[model samples]
Target: METLETLSDKLDTTGDIQSIVRTMKALSAVSIRQYEQAADAVASYAKTIDMGLTAILHDRRAGGLSLPHTGSTDADVAGLIVIGSDRGLCGRYNETVARAAVDCINDRTAVLGVIGARAAARLEAQRHKADRLFLLPGSVAGMTPMVGRVIVEIESWMRERGVETVNVVHNRREGRSRAVPTSSAVLPIASEDLQQLADARWPGPGLPFFRMDRDRLLSWLVRERLFVLLYRALAEALASEHATRLAAMQSAERNIKERREDLTSDYRRKRQETITREMLDVISGFEAVSGSDD
Candidate 1:
């Protein structure tokens, strides 16, 4: 029902919107690459930390090495760190992580530590109060400071809440462009993993002697393990965040293309009708003049 001029104006507006979507899509692609690289780099560091922990655990079985705030057997409280995104363009990214965190509560007495404003809002909407709220780092370069802040906040929570265990709920990268919500426990390091580390065979020619006290060495290794675990979680979450954005943007781009094509078709049809009507008007006017001359 639109006139030719109206349709033409709408087409121009649609074109502008399409251009904006394309720009966002391009930005998402770049962000995905940057986060992917950061995740990969952190992965290597995590492996090195794992190897060191394996060696330390194997050598110190008799030293009574203990981790501070590891929680006594009677401790029943849990602390959860939920990682999500601050932005909303990515479809269901924050909701998926928030749901995972909620499921993890499972009637346990829990203290929630949330990262990202969008995530905190989702949990708060579900009637969960965050004991610690943190903003996600803007880039890979800022992860170190972010991790440091998380460490301090978590330690404080452990002491104040008498937390028995710590868990992280986040979106983990599955492949190049896919991610899935995942939950992992950090405190009371899984018995299976500890046993594996304890029983692991040393790759070198012989057992190496440590210059430091066994307890000190174990404490340092335990702290490093904890840091690496949290760091890896953050990295995975960041990478997954970007991947979701990229996928969402790609989908939006497709929708935009379809809409633009529809608008173009409509514009053409309207213009054609206008042209036909104008031609008919001209011919009728000429006929009237010819009749007057006759």
Candidate 2:
């Protein structure tokens, strides 16, 4: 009621800001749950495949697969896959990944395949051409198929372009930018890289002994293993994005709460001061009138 001109403005501004923070928090929560689910699925699949791969290698007897060329090979022509968020408000999620990707490609003359538009923009800003720009779906579930497809495409690219080295540029769930982790992939059907694939596991108890042509089985196992790896990397990247967004939203909400509380306190104090000053003025005026009368 006191003529504190800014009181209404403060409430309006703080209310709007608080609502924005709340919305962000809710969106982040949804994303976190989604990422967690995807991560679980991919992790389980990878574990099973790893077991299978190990078994197959063990059965090979003569070191699984042989290395064709000598140990030494030409330096890698890297293929960078940088994953980032499609939506903003997750503080620095895209920026950090972009920075890491840029740093990686700069180190080696390589082709970059940017996974998100924001990341692509960052790459362009650095005056780098992303060999490919792939779009991510709104949901992580939509990502599995895309990742599988990407692996197939990347395989072809690496083979045709003679790119032996490939790595994933992605953020970690722990909110740390791991910079650039360069990974050499199984390419050119290298005896070395094929050997790198863990051997397939023995069928579980109660499962009838599966008979198959060993060579065909090996081929199937190799391709499936590659797809599994690609899926895992993509899932992990997606999980990190969701986790980062959740953390950022929570921080923003906390800041908004603090700001609102401060504003409320300020408004109340100013109102109280105005009331006190009016009372004082009224009392002094009465005293002055009485003194004039006397």
Candidate 3:
């Protein structure tokens, strides 16, 4: 029942919305690429660190030194880091991560650290409180500082809060335009994983050799490993966030286009009806005037 003017105004508004959706889609695509590249670089560095640890562990075993007990058998308090999106419009990106984080707690006394305000709100709604809230980095360049801050917080939790095991929950990019929630232990690098790394075949012709004390070298490598893990996780989470947003924006664009088409069709049909009615009235008047003249 909308008039021509109303239809025109609706079309204009829809056009504006379509423009915004397209802009968001472009930004999401660009962000996904940036974060994916960063994640790839971090993954490469992590492999190198793993190789270093492997060589050091192999040498330590040859020297009859006992391997360091990395994982704690009895963790009195655990720390959980939940990585989520800062902004909405990403279609359950934050909610999925929050649910995974809550599942990870599973009735344990845990210190919770959350990234992104939207995620924190979700957690709060689920009756969980964050011990600390961290803001997500705005760009690739900002990630380093954010990672450093997270590392500092982790160290504090270990040193002052009696937290032993630290776990991270985040969304990882699945296939194109999909994100899956995943969780991994970040601290006390599992001994089994370390053993696997030590058993891995070296790619180079020469075996890795370090000139520093084995324990000291292992400590340095562990720190680097932690850094790489956190950095890579953050990158992956950001990429997944963008991918989800891109998908949502694509859906929005499709709906907007359909709505615009429907509006256009309605406007055209109504205008044609009005013109037909006006022509019919003019013909009738002409016939009446001709009859009167006759």
Candidate 4:
């Protein structure tokens, strides 16, 4: 029979442990959907803008206008953006990004725009100055307006700071800590990346003789392409973030389970020891009475 004391201790441990695991589970569930919505919005731009960019490239070459590449990278004043989790349960999610940020642009002069509080904290710990740190609202819808605002802010920051390049650091994973610390340039766009976009098959076959005013179409195409590139970056970082969170939660859940089992086993052992001692005491007491009567 398990003693009340032992059982109580086991209950306390289980309750405390379960609470943490439950919180982690809820966090994972919430983060997953947020990533999905953000991803969908960002990914859609790839489809909408890629074809138009291709047309622009083809026409530009035929004419003599050299459209500036959106994918090319350069180092002058650098802009670094890191996206990490606001809540922790996902071990190493914030650390991985933070370290990568440190490795790449941890310099004091580099301007930082951090997306999560945890990441911002880490950067601050390392004494990195953050010009802007963003904590995304819960839902992707909340993030929509933020997208443009952030872009504008980053643009303004880069110009004011004389930043020539922008790099983003985030965890990339579908699940597990398999997250790769990724760095993507956000400034002076890479021409090669843009050229790849130019190659994507867009709907409406290239008209054998496409009819349109070249200048108007070209300007519109450039704007759309820029939007697409920025959107893609945000989407990819978010997907990676979700995967990291889920993996961390799952791992935490497992650890709690193991710890609970160990504590329960210990409690049971202690309870049995107490019960056996009580039985021996009773027997000894009866024997002593019998001896006295004799």
lDDT of each: 0.80, 0.66, 0.89, 0.69
lDDT of 1 at 126: 97
- Model 1: runs farther than 4 Å from truth? 62-74, 175-178, 207-213
- Write one digit per residue (lDDT tens) for candidate 1, span 1-294: 688788788888888888887888788778777876876777888777777777777666656654223344335787889999888788888888899888887555468899999999999999997888999998878888898898788778777777768888999977765769998887756666777777777888866677997668766766677777788888889888878887887888788789889988998888888899999999999999999999
Ranking by lDDT: 3, 1, 4, 2
**Model 2 ranges with Cα > 4 A deviation:** 1-5, 51-76, 106-109, 175-219, 273-294
Q: Which candidate is the best by lDDT?
A: 3
TM-score winner, 1 or 3: 3
- The residue pairs in collision within model 1 are none
Cand. 4 Cα-lDDT: 0.69
Per-residue lDDT tens digits of candidate 3, residues 1-294?
788899999999999999999999999999999999999898888888998988887787778876777758358788899999888899989889999988988645468999889999999999898999999999999999999899889889888888878889999999987889999888888878877876777777867666898878888888889899899999999999999999999999999999999999999999999899999999999999999999
Local accuracy of candidate 4 as per-residue lDDT tens digits, 1-294: 656676777779777877876786676667766666666776666665556667666667667767644432545567777877687656677888889988887343367788888889988899875678787556556665656766777768755877667677777664444777877765655777666755555456662345777776765665455455555555556666666666766777788788777777878788788799999999999999999999
TM-score of each predicted structure versus truth: 0.88, 0.73, 0.90, 0.76
Question: Of the candidates shown, which would achieve the greatest TM-score relative to the real structure?
Answer: 3
lDDT for 16 in candidate 1 is: 89
Q: Please provide, for model 2 over 21-98, each residue's C-alpha lDDT reduced to its tens digit, 9 standing for 90 to 100.
A: 778767766776676677677677766655655555555545445423311234556566777666676667777877
How high is the lDDT of residue 232 in model 3?
90
> For candidate 3, which ten residues in a row score worst on lDDT?
65-74
